[model samples]
Target: MIRIKRAYEEVKESDGFRILIDRLWPRGVSKEKLKIDLWLKEIAPSSELRKSFGHDPNRWEEFQSKYRDELKEKSELLIQIKKLEEKLGNISLIYSAKDEKHDNAVVLLELLNN
Candidate 1:
């Protein structure tokens, strides 16, 4: 199974193969503190799309749609994520977004699970 978690949260033993799915590093979080298994920047949404949404709740639907399209085109990255998922008991996708409801990791988790 896949899980979405905030970058600031402490890594638990149950969070197997923790991966950071953000294009940019989360603010104020040092690499050492994150306890990440991988940083999949290539799997993140393009900067253009990220800036366009700007975390607007009104754009959430469109953001998710567009982001899925991006993911569709990134089959290699998806395959990599899938490979990790197959190897690990649990896959934790970490993101830096302040709003848990609107982050890219949520969309990624949905897409990955589907």
Candidate 2:
């Protein structure tokens, strides 16, 4: 199974094989505190796209659409996520965004489950 989590959330044993999917590290979060197994920055949205969206709810739809298009070029990274899920049973895609419902991780969770 695939799950999405905020980088600042408390770590849990059930959050298996945690992967930090943000292109940039969460501000003020230390490596030890994050407890991530992998930092898959390449799986994150491009800097241009992220800047364009700016986490505005009004822009979420457009962001998701454009992000999905960008994801098409990241087939290998997507496959890598799948492999981790299969091997780990429960993998979490971690992000630093404050808007939980409108983040790239949300889009990725939907895509992976489908």
Candidate of highest lDDT = 2
lDDT of 2 by residue, 1-114 (tens): 899999999999999999999999999999999999999999899999999999999999999999999999998999999998887799999999999899999999998888
Global local distance difference test of model 1: 0.90
> Which clashing pairs does model 2 show?
none
**Model 2 TM-score relative to the real fold:** 0.98
Model 1, residue pairs in steric clash = none
Flag regions of model 2 displaced more than 4 Å: none
Which candidate comes out best when scored by TM-score?
2
lDDT by residue for model 1 (20-109), tens: 999999899888899988999999999999999999999999999999999888989888888888887698999999899997988988
Clashes of 2: 0
Error of 2 at 13 (Å): 0.7
